[model samples]
Target: MAVTRRQMLAGSGAAIVLSGAVDRLFAGTAEAAQAGGRSGYGPLVPDPAGVLDLPRGFRYTILSREGEPLRSGEGPVPSHFDGMAAFRSDGGRVRLVRNHENRVTAKYRVPAIERVTYDPQGLGGCTALEVTSGGRVLSERVAIAGTAVNCAGGPTPWGAWLTCEETEDRAGTNGYTRDHGFIFEVDPRGRRTDPEPLTAMGRFQHEAIAVDPRTGTVYETEDAFDKPFGLFYRFLPKRPRGGFGTLQAGGRLEALRVPGVPDLSAIQEPGTVFEHVEWVKVPDPLAAQTPVRLQDFGKGGITHAQKLEGCYWGGDRVYFVSSFARSRDGSAADHFGQVWSYEPSRRRLTLHVVFGPDTDVQAPGDSPDNICLAPQGGLMLCEDGDGAQHVFGVTRRGTVYPMARNRQNIGTDQAPAWGEFAGVTFSPDGRTMFVNVYEPGTTFAITGPW
Candidate 1:
């Protein structure tokens, strides 16, 4: 593909320029989008693109897929699985709340659950699956209501799931329910609210969410396209009390702008963050009702700054991965296609690790879609890209390893390729891990060691 820097900028109104030889290599029209730009990061060392390549001891098993029948007896549900969360309700069994980012028109059937309902046009719909540590499905149910393109969201302290919609267009409009472009909470027990969009969470194209247990502060990301692109936001609960209801009280919304970066507003740089750090509060929270401009960093470009997709809270910091817009050339190129850590306690954010091989600056840096920390003190990343996709692991010291290959490569044409692996998490005991493929629309379990 001839993905040139100029064409990339012109095609998308997002103005920001990428630097380095990597930019020149992708300086054509066709190749720019496919190559997540360039950074020092390269592909995995053993490069397990077509096969499931993990460390010495790890194995993956398919738990569910687009047309697979679950124990619930419901017809084979369609695919489009995105983010997921794992909870241990029984001693040996765990409950997984998985998001299905599908529009109403291209909707998938949920497993048997007479009580559950969804907008014909895919508004909001997530599934609750019961699985064993050995990777067997015990049962599956549809949870959440009236939301579409349920992207990625964070798990709550009280054991609830926050599901996000990646589109501003509502259901019925574009064949999707007008339900929301907001955040909704789902209880594992299958209880749901009246389908409320935590307006406090800001609107735009909602992506992943993370919370500060210390302050009950909720941080969110905007996944919009076009002029505004998107911005990261935080919702401070009205009361000190934190729970699903806390979101209704509303709080604050802030966008990121670093002081050191130059103004690349008109260039369309894919992924870049400003050098200096500063947070600006959105003056009007309701402004999200309509598409609005959040920030104009002038020239620096959006980098560690927030292409904001997935997020999880652990240790003393908040870890988030930018889905796209990583710089391949210039000073900021080193940060493209990487994982970043933000210290909530210290109020500082730093690049925790980089993906890919060393020496070559033009290879693929991982497009980590969604992420979760393992009970073993490590991280699991759902890598999304043009080539074969897979699940990967990142150690505290910054070592990257493979966990599983998305098996959606099998079967008929509509089975879908593992284009974007979003949701990922391990059982609380660290025994079983779950992954979702947003494109092929499936979820699976990974058991064993790495």
Candidate 2:
């Protein structure tokens, strides 16, 4: 049975009836419905701080700024802060493990230590920041170093951040001495440990990851914008809940497939659901020469999407973002982005939201990157498109509304230097939310009524 917009607006009960035993993860809220039905968190107001503009009644605190010396005295905080995750610490403080999306040519690099460094020449990794419950920064230090393009990753149920590299740059290339494109674990509590790449997770252009807490299965997304695109993958660990090194020891990597659907481009349409999906094992998890998506394509059992990014686990499904997919590599019929929800229990994937192509920043077609389940019971998305970027709130009824915007300017010229919002996540207690501005690299702690 196919789910429709009308059915979604009818309520969660109707959704349950229509989809059988499948859970209605995105059921609409009364507050969302009251705000003109399907409209977002209301209009965004200008910021007095000259950094971010938020909705009325909401305020932001700049926790960490880029180009400053680290609190731990390693070096200046690395720039290009990308994906991040928040965790509760011992003394009413929150710990954040942030990714630095730097490459070999980056001017700054996170200082590398012998034990935790993967490749000294690799200029990307993660940093740990400790902040009080009141949003005051306590300390900052390099958590994992000597990696390439540490883009986005997720927190494990066992309490650690899985930092992913969004690069396929191999060893001996671009001044790199070791292989790139792997995920590394970092302890959020600033514990000392060796950094090891989980080779069994399948090396590719890893964009983001979401682990199913119930199964300990890690679902990964790849960001490949060029031909052959990327595949949605899952790593089944050898042991369900082993210590830190379980993923590194070994695992089976598989790609998602929708039984009879040869190509998944049909998912570009809103509310399209692919039922009864299956997994195709990768011939070589570590594709040293060939990419993993290509390996899945050669086997003829897997389907791929263009530029898969930003995924999170919520309710009983894994919600993932596909940033701008087209019929062909350069086709005009391109979707700015599409949000898909995958139900592991039922082995199904549903296209929850699809954005049409529109150049207007305020339009509904804005490309979405990072995503998280809102404490108010919906989804919060980080816009990564042309012109001004925004953080959009999608209600259970599928209405999109702007929640925050970047109003940072360039020098005295007053030219807008729009920065894409990344690493949107709420604190464990849900009292605060943490997000990052891609350029100039700033982390903000936002608090307000939901």
Candidate 3:
């Protein structure tokens, strides 16, 4: 909640020089914090750009890009595309459900995911695609109809797409409906216009979702705009072991609060940085309509993370990354980079990885957005920034490597880059990879060696 002078300048889109200052701030700081051992390995390449770069033989190709036409006759998809998931329908065909984070000027073109084409009438876009092993689009359709600004989402075990809207407007402005902040369930194989919004998921500025199949609990994160002090949430379905199909049955949504940092209102002030943060749980998430004040959930002395972005569930824990927790305020807390792992079994969360704010592993804006576990167990991250945006990989030993860049140049893509490299996931067999790009509005099939 605290904002600094530099943040003020950046917020106002003013010009300033903090690169040198930021560089000095990171130098020698890694070893100082290490004490005895290394934190993790740095990025694999000095700088990987435009094309996909893997270990010797791995390669990638664009399956679909924003604005591309669908086989079902839909005109094209829109911008602000975020997260996605990969699935198999026919013999070797893969299906993908992708999100779009559109705003005022942005609007959905037509239905394409479920293969039905219809005029979007200014609505934002979310699509599903059927592609081949070689990255060829066989069919594409809109999964959820009549929704806009669709952000990051998670795939349900029952084969449904949980599409989330990132706006809070009860009645959306810019011609979008008021249903902007809700979650919707779309049949990945149905017609684009067939489903209804799944209001069970608490409406807010939802950023991403991760599902715990063991408990049937849906973990979600909200993106707060001004000096982000958002909350993480968990939705328990009404049915004891329900999921996907039961979303409409309704359930309970709980907000994540850091244990200490007693006062969030204090961080609301300008030029101040939140410190001594811990995690606390808030009973209700929808209570505060405007800039919801989330409880701190961390205990002991831990750096507070502001904007909670990309998340993935693997092994016994759920991993999440914080983009831009540092750099804004001079406070050396959750800056640099961080990866937090939550162990549902023991109900404990631990810090997994921390990178220097200005280090090569971390993106310049701290916008290391979407994440996915690689076949070998490391993590693959999409850097969310302009020109410099590229896909980076993190090994189990914590080695970072730039895999590819968005040279296709979709207009208005999110940095660390949004849209194209935005959402990435491997198939069950780990032989095929699917990526969703927002701007040029496309989804691609990436296949090669491992």
Candidate 4:
């Protein structure tokens, strides 16, 4: 396949021009619908099957679901689908490396394949799928297995997925054979998957990561709740651009430290910039005794944010999310969500967007997580909040609209059940947009007139 603009952007760490995505994020409900009260492909029409609701001229294909047998003959597809990425394959097919956020007690654990299991007693991992540009599933298999809480992660410029563990389960706990919260690399092609945890990267409740393709400097996020809230981190690898196993070579893991700021949520305004940011070395990346967040950072303490999630590389900066924050949850401030961008060159961190605390929970664009730059233009954010679930879109004009909704009522007439939309991404060919519903695990390939 020919190299596309997205590929080039990934290779060079080109900056993503958000085109006012930040401004639109917290836009008032009145201004949000300024563009005919809809943008992109227009308002979403309800899905007839009661699955995924999409805009007119758009449709979705359920590629796989929980409890289904894999086309590759591996065991059933694992439950709790989360983060995902698409890679160009040899033929016209696209490769997907999807994560399953199964806990230690999950009923449907990811099955081992090609002898690539991380820990026998662990219950979470990732699966690989090969599909056509039109959303046909050609094959499915386990890419990595026996890890735990494989939540959201980011894609690599070298064409791979960095699956993160959102737990810090220690050895001997709940039948765990080894320490559980480190990042692992998975090659969707089923070649070069390193079963060993990238130990140099600190062990913690890792939510996501973004690799600067140019320098291989990894920006990581810890999603722990306040018992010492999570900190933003980076792993400076020894061998920068080396493909799969390069992370095993070792690197330095450090947490972000914004001079006078200890809690990031205190900043309520967008465009709040902190300059000359520093990184403190993690005392114990393995966290043998004390968790990384609990470790001492001395006089200049590290910066912390609640629910740090969804990481991606745009242009020369690394963008990440704080799913949501509440003062009642011990946060310094409260807000619906926040998106931050860090510039290595400037050694600066800026609050790019801040969702309103009053955003209608049942409406579009609340608690955005697992974000991605939509191939067509603008940004796509998965809704992980109360009320109805939707995949919200921000058009170039800074108008926010509901691009898709989860109409799957897994509950009942009185208590309708639904899952948060996650892992929103597009194929290299940009023909389909793939996303996951967390509960009852499902993957959907949404195609529409972009």
Candidate 5:
């Protein structure tokens, strides 16, 4: 059965507060649109290109594609483009740094340079591309290479990309010369750079990170799917103002702890809130044989969530995603997905949105992955769930609306080849939104009323 947003909220025991707010927000919008005979961008229109379907007055342009030659002539653009960010450059141009989530054994990879690569055999890294305000690609080239599983990462306040590896494979294991899981900083301008891993940051299956611009604290999420679920972590740099260099110098790694609440999975209902949460220092940030989450669990240091993914900092709160959680792996119960908001000032974590178990991907509560704060307000979530993938717009009041849909067709096959939509971001000026299709890898620049 398809689980509607209203149904999920009704079932939530303590989520009535959030549910009331959400109902009022949606009611106002729906009522206003009914009076005018149109609501929320006026529904998605089918695209003639058979790629992306957007609403009226919205169009998309293909900027850079996988398997194509790089502008530097080193090699073809790698596949599996994941997390990405855009920075404003001189002359109204935008520089985008994107992660390529390839593996060492993958067929395609960004070429490894002398000092720009950590491991020559490592097959995952990042690339930099320049685009104009008019949505034209100027150049695309390898920015960093020789890393493993370059998944989703956050942009630094100082204008650099923090590319994270989503694996914990050791150096000597699997023909890799260096460690697999760590964060590397990449300069978006293609200037002199060093592709060294920040060992101070713990080694684990890192999914994404969000940096607090005020204190320079880094909040990280893990994407572990095992008996012991992943944890939410924070890294406090020694010299917070020095940016990435301060992180390399070493800092304190800690996990989140909700005082009396040992198991976070118990609060699965939408609008469940936990106040006065604290951070417990991690005993070892660079654990080898034992994972950090397991070690922290032993000491009863923090709570755990299943498949924690995309995270972003917005409106003085850290918003993150727990792709899904189930009791099978020691979780409290089963849920399709969840969105959490951590307010540093209030020292509390609130369950902002909860998705019930439903197979309908077009519904309000599908599994969400890479997320970015919208220029106007709320968030832009990239759907990584079953069925056709879509880009969903989530309002601050918890109303969800489809922004775009993937309609890529396989060769000679009329049936839709549903690929995950990732790396959803917007231009600094908010004029253009960028997103990627995981399979056959394509990056797009979308323009609309938003």
Candidate 6:
């Protein structure tokens, strides 16, 4: 990634400029690498600051917090910071584009900026932050607005952020003027990306996306919590380039189907491989009446799973997360969580890991949402299950360990509540790790000895 400068800086003022830098592992950068080995930097130490408990030598600095007035006066930093990505910016700075997963009913929304605002009536969007390697946030602004449920997303090889909306609400619902549930491209370099939703991508309760740099083909997941659950999808674009606005040219939307496997949750064992997977075209990408997942796709309906979330492209393959599944919740099977990787070259998908029913919900191996690959070694998972929230690290040997815990108590002193961690990413240099606490919606830049 080249270091690019901002064309036009926007914001009320500069960031709070926190001190120090903390590092460990995050997805999508060489410095951060795919993952680490066993005994990852030792055990976790309780944080004295009562924000995030980190492993010994690691420290976190809050770059942007909810309810705090952004330097750009963009409505007190819209809350529910979800999925995010980091880029190499000009002058040794790391540019972050974060998603605010607010709904139309929320009080604070990503302020409607002139060119970047999509639908002023909607309440979810993304914000860009320019921060130095030392954890100093220099400038911030609204990268895109007017979208709903800006959830987890992936970074494009062409150096851009793909923000997904986790909603199927139409313009008539919730007083919205535009249809929800689509992916919006964002440029972190202060470049104005078209606010138009990439409708070519099938819409359904969207979760996250991962793009194959080799083919510019995008793999997407749906987080539908309904009776039939959601299906995994891939978009073959008309234009196969990583360049900005390339996805707007329209594409063919399809769902993955395994011969005998109809539901992904049925696969219980790790290392279980599905070969010769077929892609079934979706009848309705617009979801005008029947959702993409509901559309009929021939003999055996397309494959579906429960709570499919975080996604990232790493090691010549695409990895995704299934937060959790329960038969009581209408799933085919039950498990705490599952991580799977797909190899495009071989057209194969493998169950990399599956959390068993006996797994501890609060443990590092529990339910994982947003995920990132560590260039140096192991994969990082953002905790999203019961008990205390944490950022878990998985070693190359398949061992799971806690890397960071949410210490910020959101509830009363009698009963503390910590928000789940989201958007685990690292700068190009891998000197810093960027993540967010979903509740109270604070973005942290942690730097330490990797």
Best by lDDT: 4
Extract clashing residue pairs from model 4.
14-315, 15-315, 16-315
Expressed as tens digits, the lDDT of each residue in 355-439 for candidate 2 is: 6543222334266898887665666778786656777666565555667777775434544446788999988877788999988
Across residues 1-450, which tens digit of lDDT does each residue of candidate 5 receive? 354443342223112122312321121122231211122454567788788888778899999888889888879989888999999998999999999898866667878866688899899999999999988889998899999999899998888888889998988888898878888888899774468888888898899998898898899999987857888998988878854355778788889988766556666566677778889887778886678887844444678888899888765778788887778787877776777878898997887666665323234536778988666655577888665677876554555566787888543454445678889988888779999988778899998676
Expressed as tens digits, the lDDT of each residue in 1-450 for candidate 1 is: 345332232222222222221211111122212111111122322424443433334456767777666556655655677888888878688998988776655545444244544454454467788887677788886676456777788788878888887876744477554545777878876765435567777666788888787877777766643433466566767764686566677776766554554322222332333243666666655553445344332454432233557766665656565555534322233333544555555555454334333321222225567877665544567766654565655443333444554444544555544466768887877667777767666676766532
Tens digits of per-residue lDDT for model 6, 177-283: 88899999999986748899899897778889988988999999898777788888899999997699888999899899988998899988777888879899999
Better of 3 and 5 by lDDT: 5
Off by over 4 Å in 5: 1-39, 296-299, 358-362, 410-416
Q: What is the TM-score of each candidate against the true structure?
A: 0.75, 0.88, 0.74, 0.91, 0.89, 0.91
For candidate 4, give the lDDT of residue 429: 71
- List the RMSD of every prediction in angstroms: 9.8, 6.4, 9.4, 7.9, 5.3, 9.2
| Candidate 4 weakest lDDT stretch, 10 residues | 11-20
* Consecutive 10-residue window with the lowest summed lDDT within model 1: 32-41
lDDT of 4 at 217: 96
Estimate the TM-score for candidate 3. 0.74
Candidate 2: stretches off by over 4 Å: 1-41, 296-299, 327-333, 358-365, 410-415
After superposing candidate 3 on the true structure, give the runs of residues whose Cα lies further than 4 Å from its correct spot. 1-56, 112-122, 191-195, 262-291, 294-304, 327-334, 358-366, 409-420
- The lDDT of each candidate is 0.58, 0.76, 0.55, 0.81, 0.77, 0.79
| Position 159, candidate 2: lDDT | 86
Q: What C-alpha lDDT, on a 0 to 100 scale, does residue 325 get in candidate 3?
A: 57
lDDT of 4 by residue, 22-124 (tens): 6433321223233322355565675668788777788889999999998878888889999999899977798999999998668789986548998888889
Superposing every Cα of model 2 onto the true structure, what RMSD results? 6.4
Better of 2 and 5 by TM-score: 5
